[model samples]
Target: MNHFQDYTNNRSRLARIDASLFFAPTSCTPLENSVLWIAGCRPSSFIRFAYALSGLDIQFHLTDFLEGKRIGDLTTQQMTKFDELQGETIRKERNLCSRLASLQEDIVDQPFASKIFTSKNYEEEDHHYQFENADEALDEHSQHMAGVMEEADELRMKTLKQIVINILEPVQAVEYLAAAKRMRLCFQQWGKKRDHHHSNKLD
Candidate 1:
């Protein structure tokens, strides 16, 4: 095996070797680039998303993420008003994600539905008849979660934009997006390592 240093005189070939080991998240995903895409999500959109989403880690509750509450005048009055108008949809979205993504089932996560679809009570097979539409239910619930997540992303960006306009000076605000992107990358890498370590332990 030739050492990489052997390619020092061949700068182009050395760069190729270095790049082969590197994975860039900025480029569009193959699924995103497909001409006849079936997933309905556009490739360019996913490219922008994958590159920038980590910049704003907005969860369901706007205030719960990234000290988001401090960004603007997002108040209890606003939340209460939102609930009064679109509370049910928001509730369903939160409920669905909590149930689907949770390792343990929670009653708070199940409001309109009963315990039948809850994964935690699998031992209670007596309720199997109730979840006859388990597959369909899970899919519908998951869509709700996705919708909420997308909305949260919009709100996060909106909040950040306002912060840049109001709170920060012209210079610092300009650098925020790039800084957020780097922070996100670091967080994602650490999360991957942690998950890998946990999986190894399980094995």
Candidate 2:
């Protein structure tokens, strides 16, 4: 019951933070800019994010399990099962990462910029690039990127759900999810403070 209550409270707090993220300002703050650069403003980053979260989760779980064992709340058998699940999860995430990378490479190989550059007209050392069909090519690229992003996001959600449902007890799942949310919220708050501090320094 206490665990459930902690999960519920954390879940509510996370929900509020999520809402704030959704309504966050359009203009990129310093932190947002860095995130965009690292994430490449792409949906494929979802897989990477999931992989990172899983790593953190595994670390936390291992620490907790060690403590539980000391307190006689967890058994070696449970730890063994967790080890197997963790291995499987890492393998799956790596496969997905490889597949996404390949798809992104395919998209990049046939860039719209190439199409526009190849259509360049030159006369007497004067050159002008023709963008004929460039828009159409760009649109196609956008569609492909959107599709990949959607696929990545779906996989991320599915993987997380599977980990929670299959590998964790109900209470443990809730607590793990709550902790993940709290981590994200802390990062968000910290980023905002960092940005504010920088802005004040510039003033």
Can you write out model 1's per-residue Cα lDDT over 129-150, one digit (the tens) per residue?
4443455545455454444334
Superposition TM-score, candidate 2 onto the true structure: 0.54
Model 1, 91: alpha-carbon shift in Å? 15
Over 1-203, each residue of candidate 2 has an lDDT whose tens digit, in order, gives 34534643553444333322322335545565566411223233332333343443354453342332211233455456555655665665566567657755764576644654453533335555545565565556445444444444444455465545664567656655665555456567778899889989999
Model 1 pairs whose backbones collide: 32-43
lDDT of 1: 0.39
Residue 72 error, candidate 2, Å? 11
Local error of candidate 1 at residue 83 (angstroms): 23
Error of 1 at 108 (Å): 8.7
By summed lDDT, the worst window of 10 consecutive residues in model 2 runs over 65-74
